[model samples]
Target chain A: MNDHDVIDNLAESDDCLFCSDHIEEAALGILEAEDQERFEHHLSGCSICRAELARLDTAVQLLPFAVNQIEPDAALKLRLHERFLQERDAEPTRIPSPRKSESRIRGRKAPSRPMWTFGSVFAGFCVALAVIGLWNLLPSNESSTSMSGRNFQVYAMQSSDDQSGGHIGADPDSKDGTMMAWNLDPSEKHEIWCVDHEDNRWKVDDLVVADSGSAMQTVTFPKEISTYKQIYVMRNDGTQELSVAPNQAINGDEPAPSESTPAGD
Target chain B: MQSLAEGHPEAMDLLYDRYHRPVFSFALRMMGDRDQAEELLQEVYLRAWRRASRFTDARGSLISWLLSITHNMAIDEIRKQQRRPQKQQAEDQTELMISLRADGISMDTHAILTERRELVRKAMDQLPQPQREVLELAYFNGLTQREISELLDTPLGTIKTRMRLALRKMQESVELQSLEAT
Candidate 1:
C-alpha cells in the first residue's frame, strides 16, 4: 500500500502487541528476546504501531540534545587532526598497486584519429559516439564537480521568502563549486540554476527537500565565476527564485580565514 | 565520507569540525569527566578515520552516527569506572551549563534549525522532573528499563509509565509548535 493508504489504515487495529503492552519497552530496546521478537513481527504489519514506534525512536534520538554542548580544547582538536594525518600518510606507502602503471601506459599508447575516407566514416561515427559517452561520464553540471584547492569563495543567497536562504561556494583552482539551501517547501521539488549576464541559464542541480523543509546539499559547477552572474533556486512552477546571489559580488569579497569551515554547521 | 574512505586526510578535519562539539558534549554528559570525554573524543574520531567506508547514509545523519559512537564509548568508560574506585568529581554542573550556553554562540545556518532546538529545549523543560529524570537515565546512561528501575529504586512498571508519559508530552508540545508555526 502507498504511505497515505497505510497511514489511513492506522486507526484499524491489527491486534498490535507493542501498541497494547510493550511500546515504551520496545522503543527503549529493553524488551526481553521473546517479547522483542513478537513486537517486531507485529510491527512489520501494523502501520499504527510502527508510526508510534518511530516517534518514540525520535524522542530517544533527541535525548542527546538535552545535554549541554561542550567545546573541547583547541589543542585536543589539533592533536587528533595531526595524528589522523600521520596515520593517513603512512597508509599510502605501505601498499603499491599496478593500476597507476596500467593507466599511464594506456594514456601514452592511445591511438590517433585516421585520415578522412569513405570507409572511415563509420569509424569516425563510432569515435564521436565514444567521445559523447565519455563526456557524459565527466561532470556535466556543477553539482558533481570535485572540490579541492586553496582559492575557495563563498556567497550567501537570500531567499525572497524570508524563511528560506542559500549559500554557494566556488574554488577556482578546483574548477568546481557547491550550493546549499534551507527552509524550502518540503513538498516541492527545487532546482538550482546558474544564470549568465546574457540570461543563459544552466541547470546546476536538483534538491529534494527534507521533512523539516530545510536542506543542505553540495553541488559542483563547471564554468568559472565570471561566467555566471547569478545563482538561484526554483520550484517546478517556475514562479520566482527561492534564493539568489550575484557571483562577482561574493567573489571579490575577501573570504574569512576560516571561510573553509563548518561555521554554518 | 566518500572522501574520507578514499583516504583523504582533509575530510577527517572537516568531519571533526562538524561533529566535535556535539560528540564532546554527549561524552561529557555521560562520563561527567572532562579528561575522559577528551579521551573518548580522540578515540571516536580515530575509529571514524579508519572505518569511514563502513558508514552508510541509510543508517542516519553523520552527526547521529558520531553521537552513537560517543554514547557507546561513554557507556564503556562508565562500566570501567564501576570496576574501580571513582575518580574525583569533575567540573561543577553550574560551570558546565554556563560553558554550554557560551558554546552555542555558533548558531545553525538556518534560523528554523535554531528555532527547532529551542522548541525541543522548552518541551523538555516542561516535562515533570520525575519523568525527565527517568528518560535521561535510560538514554544517556544506556540503562535498560530494568536496570533503571533498580538504579532509581522504582518499580519497572512505574519507570515505563514515566517514559511513556514523558514521550507523549514532548510529542504533543512539538506538534503544537508545528501548528503554530504554520
Candidate 2:
C-alpha cells in the first residue's frame, strides 16, 4: 500500500487532545508534573478518555507475553531468597528515649539490680546500663536497648577507634540476636551483617549514623547467633569490613563446619 | 504476594517459579542480552520481595506490576549507557503463532495466564508493522510518544495515530477472543 493509503487507513481522532497527548506517558507512569496533573484533571469527568487509558494500560501490561519465554538461572532465585530472609529477620528497632526524670538523675545510682539477674545476663544488663549512662551524657536524643535474657552471650565489637565500640548478643537456643554499634562514620550509613560458617552473609539492618557519627544504634534479628561465625560492619553496598568480632579470622583457609552440623562440632 | 510480605519463604519460592520465566523473557527482549536479562531478573524479584507489603489490588494485577519493574530496570540500563537498541528483525509471524499454539503441550503453572498470553500474542501479530513498532517502542521501552517519534524519525502526528490505532486493534482482538471463548 502507498504511504498516503496507509495514512488514510490508520489516521485516528486527536479530538481528545489530552488522551492523545498523555495516554502513552501515563500508561508508562512517566508523565511530568504539569502533564500528569492536567491528565488526571481531564480524566475526572471524561469517561471516554478514562476508557481509552484503561485499554492502553492493558496492552502495555500484556507486552510481556510477546517475548518468548526463557527461564532465569536457578542460583538467582537462591540469592534473592537469601536476601529476602535477611530483610525479613532484620527488623530495625527504633530506640525510644528514656523519660525526662531518668535524664535529670543521671548522677544518681542506678536502681538496685534485679536479684534474679546473674552471669552473662547480669553482665549484659550492666553493659546496657553503662551504655544508657553514656547515652545520657551525649547531647543526642537517640539511644538503643536490648531484651534481657541469660541465654544471650555478649560479643565485644572492636573498631579502629578505642572510644567507639558496641556489643552484639545472641541466644544459642533461639535464633534471636541484638546488635548495637557506636563510633561509626556518622556521615555514611553503616550496615550490620553476620557471616555464617558457610560464608553466607545476612544483613542485620542499615543504621543511619547520627550527626555525631559516633552515635550508638541497635537492631534486633531472629537468627541463632551461634550459626554465624563472625559479625562485622560494612558500607551500604557491603564494601569495606569496618569492624569485626574475634578481632581476626579463626584461621586462614580452614573450612568451617556446615550449618547443619551438630552443636558440639 | 501477601504471604511473601508476611515473610514466608515458601511463598517467594512459589511466586518465583511461576513468574521468573515470563519476567526473564521480557527483560531479555528489552535488553537483547541473556546475561543482562538474568541480572535484571534477579533485581526485579529482590525488589518485589522487599516491596511486597506495599502492593495492593488498586495497582492492577501482579503480572502487570512485575512487568512494570522489568520495563523500568531495562530502560534505566539503556539510558545509563546512552545507547539505543539496534532495530531488530521482525520475528517470523507463522513461527510465533505456531510456537504459541504449541505451548499447551505441558501442564505448567498459571494455565489461565498461558491462554491469555496466546490470545495477546495473536492480537499483537495482526497489527501492521509500523503500528506494532510504535506500540512496542512505547510499551517495552517506556518511551513517551514524542520520544518514539524522534527515535523512529516519524512525524509526531503519525506516531500518535499509529499508537491509537494499534491499541484499538489489540483491544478489539482481545474482546473478540473472549467472545469466541464464550
Candidate 3:
C-alpha cells in the first residue's frame, strides 16, 4: 500500500491497537505481539500516535499508582452505616420531610425536646387555659398580657363579612419573633396572618381581629402568673388558628410580649 | 444486594463499610474541605440507598460505578462553590517544584512512585488547560473518551490527541524526575 493508504489502513483497522478504540486495552498491555509491534511502528512515525503510546505507557506505569489502597475511616463508616440503617428502617415509600432533610444538611444536633415535648407542654397549657375560663376574660378588642416570664400581645379585627375573623399572636419567645398580623378578610373565607418582631408584640396585638365588632379588647396578666409556660391563641369561632412561636416562625422574627403587660386576673 | 434493596439494616451497614473511605477521599480531593467531604460522603451513600437499582454488574464493578458517582457529585459540588484562588490551584505545582528542588539525587524514586500522589497532579498542571480537563475526565473520572468529547464539545480526535499528549507529558515528567534523582 502507498504511504497514505498504509496510514489510513492502519488508522481504520480494528486490530490496530494504537487506535483510540483499542488504546485502553493496549495501554493495559493486553495486545498481542503483532498488534504491539504495529502500534509501536505507528508511534515511531506519527507524533500524535507517538504521544498516545507514551501516555499509555505512562498510564500503565501509573497503574500500580492507582492501586494505592485507602483505608476507610472506621468511625465515619459506622456513622454512615447507622444513618443508612435508620433510613432503611423508615417507611420505604415515605418521602423525607423537607425540614428533616434540611436539618440533616445543616448538621443540626437533635433538639433537646422530644417529639411530643413541645406539643404536650403546649397542649396542657391550652387545656388549662380553656378550662380556667381565661378565654372569656380576654376582651373582645386588642389585649396584651405577660405570663411566666413571657409576653403576649393579641389583636382582634372584624371580618369584612362581620362574621368569624382571625387573630395574630405576637409572642417574643417564639423563634424568629416577628409581629404576626393575620386578619380575616370578610370577602374571602381564607384566614391570613403576617408576623413581625418589633416594639414588642403590640403591633400584632393591636391588629388581632374577632367577630365582635371593632371593640378594642385588652387583657393584662400579672407578672406573678408563672404557671403558664406556653401560650395558645384560639379563634373564638372554634376554627384552628395557625400557632407560631419564636422557634416556629419561618424566619425566627416573631417578637414576644413586653413584661410590662399585666397578667390575666 | 437483595437485602440492601429490600431495606435490610445490616445490608446498609455492609454497604457503608464497603464504600465510605473511597467516597470521602474523592470528595476531599475534589472539594478540599474535610467537613464538606464528610457531609457529601453521607449524602452520596444516602443517595445510593435511594437509587440502588440503577447499579448493575453488567456495566462495571460496584466500586467503579460508585467512584464514578462520587466523582461526578464532587465535581458538581466544586462547580457550585466559588473557584478557589488561582494560587491555591497552583499549590500542587508548587509542592512538586519544592520536592524536586529539595532532593535532586538522594530522594527515593520508589517513594515518589508509590506516593503517585502528586506526580499525576503536577503533570496535569503542566498540560494546557483544555488538555488537563480532558485528561481529568478520562483518567481521574474514568469517563470514556467519547463521553469526554461530548462533555467538552470537542471533536473526538481532539480528545484523543489531548489524552495522548497528557499521558506522554506525564510519562516524561515521571521519567525525568526519576532520571534526575539517579
Please identify model 3 stretches exceeding 4 Å from their true place.
A1-74, A89-91, A94-265, B84-164, B167-182
Give me the displacement of residue B45 in model 2, in angstroms: 1.6
The superposed Cα distance between candidate 2 and the true structure at residue B20, in angstroms, equals: 0.5
Model 1 residue runs over 4 Å out of place are A1-50, A86-265, B50-60, B76-92, B95-116
Q: Is candidate 1 or candidate 3 better by lDDT?
A: 1
A1-265: candidate 2 lDDT, tens digit per residue: 7322433443254435655566666765545445754565455435666766776677667767777665556687787788778855663321112222245436755333211111233355457645544444455322112222333445666554233455554433334344555434453457676666666555676666554333334455434455566677765322333455432322232223324332321
What order do candidates take by lDDT, descending? Answer: 2, 1, 3
Candidate 1, true inter-chain contacts retained:
0.41
The 10 consecutive residues of candidate 1 chain A with the worst lDDT sum are A92-101
Candidate 2 regions with alpha-carbon error over 4 angstroms: A1-16, A28-34, A37-48, A89-265, B57-59, B86-110
lDDT of 3 by residue, A1-265 (tens): 5323433455643434345544643453333334544554344335655455444564444432342233334577677767776765552232112233345535644343322332343354345434333543455333333222234433232333222232323343222122222222211122222223321121123224322111112223222212223223333222223333323333333344344433322
CAPRI tier of model 2: incorrect
Residue-pair clash count for candidate 2: 3
In candidate 1, list every pair of residues with a backbone clash: A142-A220, A142-A221, A143-A219, A143-A220
Candidate 1 C-alpha lDDT tens digits along A1-265:
6322343456455456345566776665445545654565456446678777777666555566666555778898788878877766653221111222244435453222211121243344345434433443565453244332334555667655344555555543233455545545554567776665555556677776554444555565545544556677866434344554444335456532222222110
Model 2 earns a TM-score of 0.52
Q: How well does chain A score by TM in each candidate?
A: 0.37, 0.35, 0.19
* Candidate 1: tens digits of C-alpha lDDT, residues B65-85: 677667656765665676321
> What's each prediction's TM-score?
0.50, 0.52, 0.33
In candidate 1 chain B, what residue range of length 10 has the lowest lDDT sum?
B83-92
What does the lDDT read for residue A72 in candidate 2?
56
